[model samples]
Structures are given as structure tokens and as C-alpha cells.
Target: MSLRALLVLVLLPLSGCVPRIEVAAPKEPITINMNVKIEHEIHIKVDKDVEALLKNQSGLF
Candidate 1:
């Protein structure tokens, strides 16, 4: 091949090696806020009535 054609072919691939860059700047400060609430309740029951036992035991003494 001719020297001119060979030089053109070699330089074609070098054009793609150039780098590209982009930059951005922030204009305001960032802020975040969060709120949470929790609630709990419990209930219990006796196997036998407690008031009747106290009443029966009072007469035994």
C-alpha cells in the first residue's frame, strides 16, 4: 500500500483514545428529618377466682 494510505489508517484509531469529562457543583446544604412512635399493652387472668379464696380462708382461723 501507499505511505499516505497507511498513515491515514494508523491515525484513525488514535482519535478514539481522547478522554471526556463532566463536572457539577452543589448550590445548597442537604438536610434530613425522621419521626417515630411506639405503643404496647398487656392483660392477665387467674386460673381460679382469688376473691372467693380470700373469703373462705378468713373463716378458717
Candidate 2:
């Protein structure tokens, strides 16, 4: 048999295995839930005289 004919016979079976590619998104909708809680507190310490002064002088700050 000819070399070209033999090569064609061998490669013909492999031609059926051509790769197939598919791109798809999720069937259900995508959801992102963020249950976040932010808590903060501030504390100020001053002497009795300073606290009284601040109360008497409203526009000091």
C-alpha cells in the first residue's frame, strides 16, 4: 500500500475526536449577601473643674 494512503487511513479515525468547547452561565441567579454590623463608642475623661468650666463656657470649643 502507498505511504500516503496508509497515513490517511490512520488519521481518518482521529478526525472524529475533534474537540468541542461550550460556554454557559449558571442556571440559577447569583446572589451575594453581606450581613455586617458596625458598632463604635467614645469615652472622654476630665477633672470636675474642667467639666464645670466647659458647661459654663458653651462656646469654648
Candidate 3:
């Protein structure tokens, strides 16, 4: 067999593997739902002799 004919036969089988692409259009609106929750932790440290009071008015004398 000739070199040209052998090369043609080898390349002919590869032509069938060409990619085929397709596209489509949407008819309705796409809906997406995402639910997220965040939690926070707070810690406060005070002196050992200091007292915690909301309203202290006994020192008015």
C-alpha cells in the first residue's frame, strides 16, 4: 500500500469524533431558595470587687 492511502485511512476514522453542540432557551423563570442562619456568642468579665447594679441612688446623702 502507498503512504498517502495509509495516512488517509488512518485519518478518516477520526472525523466521526467531531463534537456536536446544542443550545436551548428557557420559557419560564428559574426560582432559587437559600436559607441561612447565623449565631453569635458574647462573654463579659468584670473585677472581683465590683458589683453589678442597674440603678444605684443610695449615695445621695
Candidate 4:
């Protein structure tokens, strides 16, 4: 390949790596407040048959 063709190929990728200029607009500050409340009441009742099966399980051995 020619030197001009190789130079063009190398310079094309380098051009894409150039940093772009950025302009940021000014903004006003804001304040926010939030209040949250959570209440949980759980009651679990197990029957005698399920309690007996759980107590006699061989997997515990």
C-alpha cells in the first residue's frame, strides 16, 4: 500500500478519539423532605399433624 493511504487510515481512527467540547447550563438548588411509617403484625398457627411430621422427619438424622 502507498504511504498516503496508510497515513489516511491511521489518522482516521485518531480523529475519532478527539475529545468533544461540552457546555453545561446553570441550575437552581432544591430541597426535599419525606416521612414514611410501616407496621407489621404476623401470627402463625401450626396443626398437630404437621407438627408431628416435622418432628419425625429422618432427614434431620
Candidate 5:
């Protein structure tokens, strides 16, 4: 009979409606293509005595 009661009764049904959300994966699988080129260089330094040993073509190498 009151205005507040009437408003509550009118809006009560609207509160029952909840939004539904769905998440689905794609039918086709995902593919990742990597065309990568890697280049590297190494530098070694030795003492003068070891360098002389290697230059002499010792069997150590």
C-alpha cells in the first residue's frame, strides 16, 4: 500500500535476471612460425708462451 512497498514489488523481478557469459576456443588451432637466424663468433686470447707453443705445431694440440 505504501509507495516504497509498491516500488519494491515492481523491481523485485528485475533483480532475478543475471547476464550469462560464455568463452570458447577457436575451431582452428593456433600456429606460431618463427623464421629466426642466429649468428655467433668466439675470440680466444692466450699468453705469449702458449702462443709460441701452438705455433711450433706441438702434439699438444
Candidate 6:
């Protein structure tokens, strides 16, 4: 075989592996605002407080 023919066969397969790539940037700016405000309040009222109820054992189960 000739030197030119051997060189062409070894290099031809390598050309198919290279790929073209492209990249693009966004046109508008990105902004995020998360101002979170959380509030929790618990109010409880019971009739005949605990002292009066414990004094009388009639309601005891």
C-alpha cells in the first residue's frame, strides 16, 4: 500500500466526532423578592377555673 492511502484511512474516521456548539445569554434581568411575614396568636378561656372544679368531686369521671 502507498503512504498516502494509509494516512487518509487513519485520519478520516476522526473528523466525524467533532460537533459544532452555540450559546446565547438572556435579554432581561432576573429579580426575586421574598418578604415573608408570619404571625400566630392563641387565646383560650375556660369557665369555673381549675380550683373550683377540683374542689367538687361530683364531676369526676
Top model by TM-score, which number?
5
Q: Could you tell me every candidate's TM-score relative to the true structure?
A: 0.37, 0.54, 0.46, 0.39, 0.59, 0.37
Look at candidate 2 and tell me the lDDT of residue 48.
100
Error of 4 at 31 (Å): 11
Structure candidate 2, residue pairs in collision? none
lDDT of 2 by residue, 1-61 (tens): 9999999999999999999999999999999999999998989999999999999999989
Candidate 3 residue 8 C-alpha distance from true site, Å: 0.4
RMSD of each: 8.2, 4.3, 5.4, 12.5, 3.2, 9.4
The lDDT values for all models are: 0.80, 0.97, 0.76, 0.85, 0.93, 0.83
- Comparing 3 with 4 on TM-score, the higher-scoring candidate is 3
Worst 10 residues of 4 by lDDT: 25-34
Which ranges in model 6 have alpha carbons more than 4 Å from their true place?
25-61
Ranked candidates (lDDT, high to low): 2, 5, 4, 6, 1, 3
Error of 1 at 59 (Å): 86
lDDT of 6 by residue, 1-61 (tens): 9999999999999989999797978789878899999999998656777656866876776
Question: Residue 61, candidate 3: how far off, in angstroms?
Answer: 22
Candidate 1, residue 33: lDDT: 69
Candidate 5 structure lDDT: 0.93
The CA-based lDDT of model 2 is what?
0.97
Model 1 clash pairs are none
In order of TM-score, best first, we have: 5, 2, 3, 4, 6, 1
1-61 per-residue lDDT for model 3 (tens digits): 9999999999999999999997977889888887879899998776644433322544543
Candidate 2, residue 12: how far the Cα is off, in Å: 0.9
Write model 5 residue lDDT over 1-61, tens digit each, in one string. Answer: 9999999999999988978899999999999999999999999999999899898977875
The local distance difference test score of model 4 is 0.85
lDDT of 3 at 17: 98
- Comparison by lDDT, 3 against 6, better one: 6
Query: If both were scored by TM-score, which would come out higher, candidate 1 or candidate 2?
Result: 2
